[model samples]
Structures are given as structure tokens and as C-alpha cells.
Target: MGSRICVFLRRAGWTMWLAVLMLGPAQFANAASPDPSLVAKINAATFEVVIPRADNDPLSYEKPLPLDLLPYQERTDKYFSVGTAFAIGHNHYVTAGHVLLAAVGDLTGAPALRDANGHVYAIDKVEKFSLQQDFVMFSLKEQPQGNAALATDTKAALNSVVYAVGNALGTGVVIRDGLYTSDTPEDENGRWKWMRFSAAASPGNSGGPLLDQNGKVIGVVLMKSPNENLNYALPIGVVLGAPDNMAVMDKRITYQLDVMEDTQTSTFKAQFPLPVSYADFSAAYMKLLYAQGDEQLKKLLQQQGNDLFPHGAGSNHILHDTPELSLFPELIVRNRSGQWSYTGRELNRVPLSGNGYVASGYVGHNFLIHLRRPDDMKVATFYNDPKQMMDLILKTGYWTREVGPEKIKITSLGNPASSTTYTDNWLRHWKVFVWSLPYINGQMEVFALPVPDGLAIMMRMNSSMGTHDSLADMKALTDFFNVDYGGTLAQWKEFLADSSLLPEVLRDAHIGFDYGKHFSYDAGNISFDYPSTLQPIAPDNMLFMGVGYYQDHGKFALQPGVIQVRLNSTDPDRISAKRHIAPSPDLDDNFKEAWGKLLHKQHPYDGVPYNDGDEMDVASVIDPPASDAPAELYTAFYGTQGTHKPEAMKAKLKLLTQQFKLKTH
Candidate 1:
């Protein structure tokens, strides 16, 4: 008989071996609770398998290394190996495809397994795996005498408590309990559906058995939540239903880049090959305009035509006929005081269609352009012209769609004042000269075009992997990303010790900017936390979540769903909670207190002032806010209060200046 059968016999308990045959219905009724003897028997049957490296001896090359190294033989041992397996029938066992991933090496290579007693057995045959589920089964070369094998069953109660027995963190067998939470339906990826539970798991727990009350396996422990106690398991039914061939597992392991094509006009996304900075963007626009040969036109307008010149063939005749001409002059002109301007001049004799005209405007040190159409003077392009030279500005200024804190409005120019006889002649020829002034330095045109799906992924990558100039801040970003991705806690500590990924540009920008300074959590989605920044922008789909660098911070370039959670809680009033891991005590305290006060109502606290360091247990009392509330309410409550207010408004100005320290000067 196989060892698996022997293990089953031990679990059945010699005294009750006959009872299992007699009490079939009774056993089924109490399937939610496992027999203590069976639980222990299952635990004992689980073994920690360690494979050792071959020594560098001449004889070693001629022969294969032994299957198992003795505990006393330290020299031959290499890296620690730990995985869990359970008896299926006699000596046969089942495990995850990933567990045997490294062991199997190339196809057709035999894997050797060792029993707890140090006995070695060759893998006789292996069955294929459930590609979607990542599971596999193999039989041992020899079967143990006198043991029965446990069969898998798909019937499991929803919310029923289940136990997972596995080798956790390379330690011996341990069991954890949780309710069967959910089964995700087959998605575009494949037919596999994950079985979710609340059981806590660690690194070495993969491939272990998630068991029902009767000690029957329900699923294989696969992965666990990095931030919480949730765990995921692969359903055992997938393994039971899999075909004989295992080649499918090979294809499933390979990563495939799938670009999803979006058909919605309102939901298009585009990706650029490289990241463009504000300076680069500005330079590109300037270059595009310069290439258009507007410099010569600009010089001609600067001449300022004189009326003393005589008409053709008459020395005494004053030059009264100003040619009706509209000149598009693109030049960077600075007055004596170092102010730049954009000049568009039309010289015309008639009011509507003039003889000589000049339209001139200034764009400060930076260039600006005013595009006009005859029908509607109200709709025109103003500010720095992005299309004139480099196409730096993504879209027409008039095409702005303001949302959130962005403010966009069009103001008409006052009627032109009548010019004196001498100046009138200069202006008559300038019939439809339009000019737009640059309003703000930080402003940039947002195109109506869609943000590409790939852009979000790229942004995530930048936020997680990009190098920052500040060593301390770079380490923090790296630590956050690594830990946020399920990397070991030790890996987070190691990231702090290494600063090779820090970039030079970021370091230079940090010198005078107090790179280490950080902001409050509720101060919008953008935060300045030293060597790194966090920009959490709600994407086009208000419900869709993403991160971006809207200001001076870096961008996120990782994919969504890479680390997604439902974020569900029983407390109805605690709709959402954002936690920031800060470095200093004072900063952490301030944020915690502020956030706490904002979320919950404070009591008198025995008239001891809210600042007294007394702890209050608010977790149970504060319920989550209703989900139907407007998202903007939360965003506004979190971001800077006066962002939407115009800078010139006195009340808003005072509020921003006094409360947020905004400087208009």
C-alpha cells in the first residue's frame, strides 16, 4: 500500500476505522468540523521538502546529487527550500504548478521527492495542470502499505469556516481559519476563478491544502493580501477536472502583453513614447513657431509707419493711404524694461476693410498668439500659441473643458478707442487684429483627446519604479512601491539602504525646494514628500482610479488591477480612509489628529482641549458615509479649500492667504 493510504489510515484512527464505514450520514452532517485526530494526522503527513545543491567535486559531475541532504550535512546545503504537499492516494500527492516550477526544469526532466523519514522516491508520472488554476498532481514511485486516499469534493457552503494547513514561513505545519468569501467568475484571462477567504498566509504557504471540516481539500492556497488578512486559493475542482496533458501550464506561465482596444469616443487613450517635461513642451512650441518664418514679419511691424512720407509721384502729398494688410508676425520682442509682446497689425483705410492697418500685441517674455474667426469673435485662441511653431499646446485654448479646480472663461476686449488723425491712419489699415495674453505660468492646454489606457499603466510604473534625485525620498517611494506590491518586509528595509536609482535631475531640483517637506493627507491627491511625490487623480471614469503627476511631482506608470481590492467595510460612515506612512512623529501626529477630527465628531473630552493626548476609541462608533454622496464633496473637502476661487476675489483671496498661505505676490 502507498504512504498516502497509510496516512489516511492514521487519520481515520484505528479505533474508528470501522466507524467511518458505519456512520456515513453522521460524518457528512458534521463536515464543518474536522476530527481532532484527523487534523493532527493531516498535519503530521505534511512535510517540508528541501532540495540541496550538488557539491563541486569531480565525482559530483559524473553523478546526480542525492534527493535529500541530511540536516547534519551543512556543506552541501544551498538556499532554503520549503513547500507543502498532501496525500491524495496511497503515496501520491498534489501541489501547485508554481511549487514544482523550478524543480521540473525542462520538460521530461525527472523530479526526485523525499519522504519525512529521509527515504527518496522518484516521480513516476505527472498529470497535466489547470492552467487557469495553477495546480498539478504526481504519483510516487512506490506506494505505502495499508492506507486510504481522500477524494476531493466541490460542495462547500458559502461563508462556511474553513482551515488552511500549510508550511508557513518555512516553519512546520500550521492551520488558520476563515470563511469562504467568494469565487470570481471566469474573466477575459481564462476560466479560472479564485476562491477568496479571510485566512492569513505567508510566503511558504503556497501549494498547501485549504481543507473543509472533514479534512477533505477544497482548494490550494495560492496567494494572500499584502495589506490585509485576505487570502486566495485555487479551487480543487479545477484540478479534478483537468485533462491528462500538462503542457497548458507552460503557456499560462508566459506573460503576454494584451493591448485592449477601446471603441468609445469618450474613452480613448493614447500613449507617448517618451515623457515630456514642461520645459521641453514649451521649447517644442517655440521651435514650431520659429520654423514658420514669422521673425521677418514681426520686424516689419516694429517700424511704426510715418505719415510725413509723400504719396507716389508727389513730394507734397502726405501718405494717407494705408494698405489693408493683416500681418501674422511671430517674434519675441522685449521692450526696454524687458517685457515681451506679440504684435498682430492690420493697416487699412476702411473701418471694416481698411487701406493701411497694423495689429500689434505682446506676449511678455513668453510667446502668445490670438487666433480669430470672423463669425464669432467670442471664440478665439489666446495665451501662448502651442500650434504656431512646435505644437506644444495640445489643443485650442477656446476648447477648454473646465472640471474640478480648473477655471476657464472667455473675456471680450473692450471696444477700440478712436485714434487721433495721425494715429487713425496707422490703425485704419489694421482692421481685424486680435491678440491674446498669457494668463498664468503653470497653465497648460489640455486636449480634448482621450488619455490612453497605456498611459495609466506607464504612470503607475513611474510612480513605483522611476528614480528620484533625493536619496531619502527616492528610498521612501521605492519602499512604498515594493511593499505595496507584496514584496517582503525585509526587501523594504533593503531599499532604504540603496540609493543607486536616484536620478541627477531630481537631486538638483530639490536643493532650494525643501525636498523633504511633505503636505497633509487631505491636501488634494498631490503630495510633496521629499524625493518622491504622490498624485492620485480620478480618471475620466469618476469611479476609475489612477495616479498622475499634475504638478512638479513624478508620474505613475503601473497597471490597474495589479494590486486592487474592493475596499469594503461594515462601518457605513467610514466610506473611505487614506493612510500615509510618514517619517516624523510630529508630522504623523498632526495628520492623524486632523484626519481624525475631520472624520468624526469630537466630544468635550472633559473640557481638556482637543489637543490633550488622550486616546479615544472611535472605530466602533464611526460608520462609513453613504456611498451615494457626491464624490466631488469628498474631493473638495480633501483638497485645498479655495482652489476653485478666482485669485482676485477678496474673500477667497483672504481665505487662501490666511488659512492655506497661498501667495499671490
Candidate 2:
């Protein structure tokens, strides 16, 4: 009896273990079945929007228009084409902010929102709006009856399956189910955090409710991924927690409006500002030079070669050998308003020329400073700061010039006492200079041949004009100018001063350069990894579907279609529908089976026309009369190639044509 009892107990234990292994572990009781009726009821609460075109009145005008005005110049009515909304309260509807923004314009031009039953409703007022989150709440003039409103729930269990019922892709009412995903922080536009999910939401689905298994509203379907099955929603808890008072709503609205207006205004200003006159530009240029560092100063000088010498030698002579000398200085007399009235002195000295030509020019007089190199056409200097360098270059009448292939020369005027002229093509390159002079209305200028290719050099010359009657008289006046030989100086200067300036000039000057090693191109193309199935969409037109899944809210995603097409087409007037055909859920299994069959098949061209070595024969068999092939067969072949070794197949085709002369024959 004891042995029998023990046997019975062991047998029961083994049975229990087998049952546990078969059934797996127990789960929570929250796995309630989804109610299809609830989805239908929720969908019934949603409405399709239709916008009517505005009438054109050619004779009507607020103000008398000119008879010569163009047709496009006349103000025409604007209207919204399509949008979506859902009932939230007795007389309130919720939709995306962008949907209602266009409807809030001038009443005469604004469009009326039409419901599914052709009932036209006026937007009484927008109760709340969040631009960042793309949400809008508006009250209707009258509410429709017989619609079942969903009850909002603040807390939803994580990973719970949820259903999104809305007019996806303008296909009327549809349902998509997926589990709750995660949430992202509020965006920069004061939008609340976004709740992420796997349920798909497409065009015309915004403002629809995401329902739980119990038929409660868990979130508002807002966005979705364009390339994937990811979706996002606005949590119902956040919507319920939002401020409901009029004062609070008004403050929020005003703040957002201000922020948007400020941003738009700033962008406009940056893109298109008031133009500056030539005279005003000169003054600003001077101020900029004064504010720059040594490196920037040198660069500024190097950029504005010939604009500093209006009456001096032409650019060809002024810039002849001095590739580095951007501008030459001239003295001029000016009135109280800073207008030049007379010439004081002009300093004409080409670098390494060994000749000093001076003309009487006054203070404040504008002159041209010229710079030219064989490789680069010409450039001129138009303005200078601190004005000291201009004074020295003008007074000294000694400029540096380049002589041989790669040599700099220094030339000096014949001394009256010594009656000797000296020219040194191999003068020791002086990277520094210091000079002091007695006060006078005279100016000095400096010039040099292409200063070590890209290296820019800054110079300063000061004078203690003995004593003057007033500060104005003693003030050191200088101007830099560039001389263009054939109107090429301006273009060169503009190119050098462009905002996208090269970085090579700004690099440390201590590093020596090998002139022989200079090359034409410096940067390479930008490359990155991207999924083969994904493609960029045009943002201006067509309709966006499933754009809320990814963190990128404004961008559209990949589309599932026979031939891939961008979510948004380039045309602004065209509306596109999301293609319904997609791979079956058992796509992976189907692919494996199909691929195995293809791998086992023998080549049909093995004994075709010509020898086996002739690739044309293989191509002929594979491409066998497209007209005779069924559409499905073509699709299968193309699709299979696209799925496996696409690049390799392309290369093989190219090789057959290029190397085997298949196409040429």
C-alpha cells in the first residue's frame, strides 16, 4: 500500500511539471480583449473636412486699383483645401493648429469647415492652441447629436495594445493597432511631451483618439513615421491637465504669437535687410577693421588692394610686382562733413620699382590700392582703420615687389645727396616695421608683392605732426584704395571677402608653406550610411502619412509601394493617396522559400546561342522578349534582383555591355 501511494505521488508531480512547461508562465489580468464596436463608435465621432474655393470679384476693391496692375497683383481669396477634426466636448472640436490657422484669417476670405453630412459650421473661437505640438481646440457654432464621445483616461498601462481610429491616408475610417512605445521631451515651441506608439496614423488622422481595449481614450493620434510603422500621439492626460481658464489660455496664446512673430521678423531681417550706401559702407568698413585682430586686419588689407588709389598709377603699374600690396594711399582735404574738396599729396610707389612719385593730395581724399597676381586677376583696398598704415605707405614712397619666379625685391628712390638709386630684388624679407615722423598733412603707404602666397601682413605707421591749432588739424587721416586694371579688382575682392572664406588663410602663419605643393581642390564630398528602402520626400506638396513615429516631426518617411515614391511630391497643387498594397505579414517566410527555389534552378542560357562564354547569350535568355513575358514574371525577376545582390547585378550588366560589346553589336 505504501509503495503504491509513493508511485501515485511521483506520477502526479511529473504530470504537473509537464503542464507547467506546456502552458508557460502566468500573465497579468489586464490583457482585455479589444472591442471592435468601440473602434467603430470612436471613428463615428470623427469628421471629414472639405474646403470650398473662394469666389473672385474682379470689380470689387477696398481701395481703387491702378488700371495697369497685373492679374497676379490683384488680391485673391485664400482657402483651406482639406483637414480633419474630432468632437471633444458639447460644441468643441479638436484638430491640428495648422488646420485651423488658415481658417482664422479675414472672414471674407476664410473657408468654412464642412462635415461628412454636408453640414457647414462656423468656427466660433479657438479655445486653445499649441503651435509646437500642432494642436488646436475650437468651439463650433452648433454641436451635432447622436455621436458617442470617448472618455479620456490620464494613466495608461505601459506596453498595452491600443487602437487608432481615423481617416488614414484619406481612405475614410480605418483602424490600426500597436503597443504603447515611449515619450519625448517637449519641443522648443512650448509643445508638451509626445507619447510614442506603434499604431499607424496617416494623413487626415490628426486629432483622432487612440483608444484602449476598454474603449477609453488613451491619447490623441497626432503624428507617425513616414518610413516605418512607428507612430506618436498626444497623451490624453496632458490634454486634460492643460489650463482651461480664459485668462490662462489668452496668456499662452499671446506668448506663443509673440515668439512666432519675433522669430519670423528676425529671419526676415537676416535674409533681407536695408541696403547700405557706398559712403556709409566705407565708414562701416573702417569700423570693422578697427575691431578686428592682427590676423583679420592683415586679411582685410590683403583683400582690398586697388580701391585705395583713385588718381594714382593704374592697377597694372601699381599692382605690377607687388602681389601683396592691396592699396596705395592718397592725401585729400575734406570739409566738416567729411567730403573731399581738394588733393593734398599722392604717394605713387610700386613695390621694388625704385621710383618715388608724389603728388599734393589733401586729407580725407579717397585713393585706390591695387593688388594683383598672375594666378589671381586683381584686387583693391577701399578703406583702412587706425589710418596710420595709409599715412606711412604714402610718405615713404617705398614699396616691396616680387621680381624673379619666387623672389621679393625692395626698391628705394635716388637720394638727392648721394645721387644714387638702389634696387634689391633679393632684399631680406622684413616681417616687421617701425617708423616715427614729424606731424604734417602728408600720408604714407606700404606695398609688397604677393605676401608669401596666402599670408596676410598688417602694417602701422604713426606721425607726431609737431603741433596743430586743433584736434582736427592734428588728426592723422588715411585712406586705402585698390586699383583695378580691367575692372577685375572688384570681383577678386568680393570673392576673397565672401562669407564662406577659405580656412587656409586663417591657419597659423608660423607654419611654412611649400608653394609647389598648392593644389586646386581641398575638400571632398560628404558621405553617410542610409537604409536602401528609405528615401527623401518633397516637403511642399502631396500628403504626409505616418510622420509621427520618428523624432523628426516635420520630415516625411518611406512609402510602401510597387515603385517607391516620395511621401510628398514636388507639385504644391497635387494631393496623393497612400498606396494600400504592402508585403504580407509572412513576408520573411515567403522570401526564404522563393530565394531557395531560385538558388536551386539551373541557368536556362547554359546551351543557348553562341558559346557559353558569350555574355550576350545569357542576357538574351534572362531578358527574353519582355512582350512575351507575363507581368508577374517580370515583377518577380525585378523584385528578386532588387532584394538580393542589386549592386552586383548592376555591375554585371554594365560589364557585359562595356567589356563584351553586347550593346555595341
Candidate 3:
């Protein structure tokens, strides 16, 4: 979701990164290993950045992660090492910015440093940071004894012998020799340069010191050039010379919604007084980040108004959709004439306890979902619990821990570590839950919206990187997601009672229904009511509410896009009222033909009956008011297997449209 942070996406960049990290057996120019005294000095200064392991119930696996997969001491350690860092001015410690950000939203124990002796020290405050350069300078709560500060150097000659020093693969701090190959300008504005080197750095090597032949810190080892052996580091001078007491997010993040082909770029920068605690720093940074993300998202939708969904040539089919009410959560895919249309998936279902089945499918990379509730699960109970949801996911073989020869099954995700709610732009409410899979360094994020039958869930699984990435990404992706809510009168009563679960619009809206008698819905802007005379008013009949762009009093906003009342699933006797936005460029032939038919008073949009067709229906359009606004249409329709005459159709439509007015006040 934030490809802006993609630069930091090199968490564990596969074997190619490892290839560059392990720089092979040969030292560049046949240089000797550093002196034992210098090695001791470097080792003393280095420490691994780590997060303590969560106290998990022994995972339900046929065979556990072999204790032998790791060194005896490491496997027995109390904390999990992530990256590396080293001391400079007694208390001043420096590491890669991305390494420090792992703590930004991590609910795990605070980010700390662990030494070779297994002593851990907590970080006290951030002194300086540069996202573009990918570096951070901070200090410890209490400095470790016996570790001397690192001597710094600003430059290293090209082709000179050097060493990549850090806890490679989290094994422990080790020194690997290589060449200080060359220099390349930094990507943004050529403000600084990156020291390209061929050194044996690894996943745990990041944020550790890149040292010169004399054992002086020349740079902070960062990332590897994926296509070549020339890996990179930030010259130590940059970290040393950065302005005192400041933090800057000067990175370029490219954000694109799934619905839009175009991307928006934010040179996202937020500078503030530093010397701040990690908690405050993280909170402040995220607050600013989400603000930017929200603004950018809105701008993207408006800027592409002409080409975005409901406007472009590709979205033609959706405008005319009469697809059956679906319980399977579907994604909007850009069709040929389908600038956007719901994806009909080929899902694989796995049975769970209590007659529940997990229907799983891949929407795109790393994105997945399960549709509706199991026959035996309760709407309120299952919708309110996240563990039950993930436990079902685990049953499908989706959540597994692979260690040595074992693909260990995780029977339960336990309770969620964090749970909250996110409201989308369309005023749709979704419940958000995050589960930590500590063994895999992974997190699973779930966003569940209540549908008529049950919940339509969208989930994201991310691993190896910091656990917060999944949470941050899922929240952003919620905006681009699609869902429709409806249910039998009984389901609606239970669902609507939880005001905290309702979107703003719905929190104030009401639906009053009495089985075998009448059904009614009333929101501030729209209302509809009906009796058994108009249609079958039963508890099991489906009533659906959709969200979309509504033109109101000269301003466009999100409101219930449509209100549909179906007497039953099989009956052709149904009533619907919906709004249509006039296309921007008016390019698509479908829209052209649609507008032609509407203007000429043709079959579907005209108040007359076209009974010979499969879609036998009568409809009338209420044009937008003559006020400051774009062209819009509100149509009330009645479709049945009963009548063929215009008068009969109009009579039913009149009953349907009596309360379907756009009330401005």
C-alpha cells in the first residue's frame, strides 16, 4: 500500500541479497582480515536490534520448530534479533532508519539492543533520522559496560579493503572482508551519495557498521543492489553531520489504488523537534503519515474522476449489473468494458469445526478472503470474534510454520493482539483485527464487513518484514475494497443494534420491519416503505443497501447508492431505487447508448413496461435539480412476472417511489 516505504522493502531480499551479503570466499584485492585487536573493538561496539518473543502457547504442530535448527544459545535466547546497530559517542547509537521503524507500530516489546554476552538495553530516544538516507541516530537507556565507542571515518578509497560487520543472519557480530568499490549519487536530488561495496552482509547485517581497513566506521551498511554485487551503505559522515535534534521523512512514496491505473506520489516530509521517546515519535510519525495518505487518496479519486470507476469505458458492465446477491466476497476487477466489475472466484473450501467451512481464494498477490458465515456460526458471536475467524483460516492450510522438514500447523491464532475499526470513504464500517505469528516474523490482518448472510472478509498476510507493515497496508487498502450489506429482517435487527459497528450514515439510519406485514428504511436523505400489497413482506426476504457517490445539494458525497427490496431470491417481483452519475468525458458507447435511451424515454429507463424481455421492468428517472451540480439521475423501478401494461407497472412503481425522494433538508 505504501510503496513509498518500498525502498525499505529489502527486509530479507532472497538469495541474491544473501549472495551480495556473503561476498563469496575471496577478499577484494587479497586483503587480510582485520587485526584481532581491531576485531575485538568492532565486536564490542556492535549489537543486534531485537524484539522480545511473544509468550505463545505451544503452537499445535505435528512436530515443532527443531531446537537444532539454530545454535543452542540462540535457540535458548529470550529475545529475537532483527537487525544491528553500534555505539559511537558513549551513548549515541546508530542504525538503518528502516530498522528503527520496525518499532513504530510493533506491539511486541520495545525495540532494544542485545550484545554478544546476551545483555539487552532499551532505546531511550531518537536524536536524528533521515528516511531518504535510511539511517537513525539514537541513544540507549543505559549504556553497556566494557564496549568502547567506534572510531569514525568519512571516506574510503575505491577498491580498498574493507569489512561488512554485523550479526549476519542473526548468528552474532562477525567481520567479513570485501572492497570499497565505488560511489553513486543518492536517488533524491543527488543531495548525498551512497558507498557501494562488495561485502558479505546479510539480513542481520543491516544497520551494522561498514568499516575501513583500519577498523574505522566508514558507513552504515544498508541494502544490496539486487541485480549486481555492488551493495550499498550510507557514509558515516552523513549520520555524523546531520543537523542536531531533527527527524525528516523525505522519501518519495508512490501510492496507487487497485481501481486506478495511475499512481500518486507524495514527497512525504514531516520534520519535528527530536529527542523524543520512541512511543511519541512513532505516534507523531504515523499521525502525519495517515494524514498524508488520506489526503493523497482523496486527491487521487477526484483527479481521476474522468477515468476512475463509474466514469470510464471499462466500467460499463457494472452500471448494468443484475448479478444475484452474492455471499462470496468479490473484488472489483477492471473488465474489458469492465473498468470495474466484481470478480467471480474459483474458491477452495476447507471444513472447520461446527460445520463451518473456510472458503478461500487469492484475489491478487498476498490478498485473500473467506465468504459468509458457516451454517452453525452465529452472526453476532462470529462477527465479534477474530480468533474464531483465523482458527478457520488455519484449518485451510493457509497458516503454517515451516522449520527444517516440518510445515507446522497453527491450530489457533489465540486472541488478536490488536483490534480496532476503520471507516471507509463510502461510510462503510469494517472491523479490523491483527494477529501476530511470531515464529515466522509475520502478521495477519483481517478487515471484516457484515453482509446480509454474514461477514465479507478481506485479509492480508505479510511476513519477514516488520509486523506493522501488514496493519498499515490493510488500513490503506480498505478504501479500495468493495462490499454490499443486506440481510433478512432478523439479521438486520441484530446487526443494526451494535451502533459501534455501524458507519456514520447507518448509525443514524433506521429500518423498521414486522414479519408478514411491512418493511421500511429511512436515512436522512432517502427513505422507502412498503406493505405486503407491494411485495411479500417476510422476515426471510432480502433487503440490500449499496454505497456509492451521491449528488446532494450541489456537492457529491458517499451515501447509500441503492436500495433494493427483493420479495425472495427466486421471485422476479422486486423493487429497486438507485442513482446514476453522468459520465465525465462521456466517452463510453455504453453510456452514450444509456443516455440516448433515457433521454428518448426507451424501455428500462422509461416509465413504460417492456414485458417481452428477460429483464421485464418499469422505471422512471428523476433528473438532478437545477442548482449548482453535475448531471445526475435517480431512478425508481418495479420489476415483476405479473404485468405487461405500462399502467400496471407504473401503479406498482408509484407505490415504490412514494417515499424514494432526495430530501435536501
Best of the candidates, TM-score:
3
Candidates ranked, most accurate by lDDT first: 3, 2, 1
Q: List the residue pairs that clash in candidate 3.
A: 4-253, 21-200, 21-201, 314-337, 314-338, 314-339, 315-339, 335-338, 452-486
| lDDT for predicted candidate 1 compared with the true structure | 0.32
Q: Estimate each model's TM-score.
A: 0.31, 0.31, 0.70
75 Cα displacement, candidate 3 (Å): 2.9
**Model 1 reaches what TM-score against the true structure?**
0.31
TM-score of 2: 0.31
Superposed Cα deviation of residue 186, candidate 2 (Å): 2.7
Badly placed stretches (over 4 Å) of model 3 are 1-31, 56-71, 141-147, 170-173, 274-295, 298-302, 305-317, 320-324, 333-338, 343-346, 351-356, 362-370, 417-427, 436-443, 461-480, 484-665
**Candidate that beats the other on lDDT, 1 or 2, i.e. the better one:** 2
Runs off by more than 4 Å, candidate 2: 1-36, 57-81, 102-113, 189-192, 245-665
Candidate 1: regions farther than 4 A off: 1-33, 57-82, 106-110, 145-148, 250-665
Per-residue lDDT of candidate 1, residues 1-665 (tens digit): 00010001111001101000000001111223367767545643454333333222211111233334334333333322435566666655777665554333211122344444444455555544443455657666666333345556687777888887665544445576778888774434555777878765666567777888778788877767666676777888777776653334212111111111111111111111212322332233234323322332223223321211111122111111111111222222223332222222322111111111112232212122222211111111211122321121112222221222332322221221111111111111111111121111011111110111100000110110011111122111121111011111122122223333112211221111222232121123222121112112211111112221111233222211111111121111111112221112323355456444434434321111122232211111112245432111111111221223222222322321122211111
RMSD of 3: 7.0
Ranking by TM-score: 3, 1, 2
Deviation from truth (RMSD, Å), model 1: 32.1
In model 3, state the lDDT of residue 496.
Answer: 83
Error of 1 at 528 (Å): 58
Best by lDDT: 3
Q: Candidate 2 lDDT (Cα, whole model)?
A: 0.34
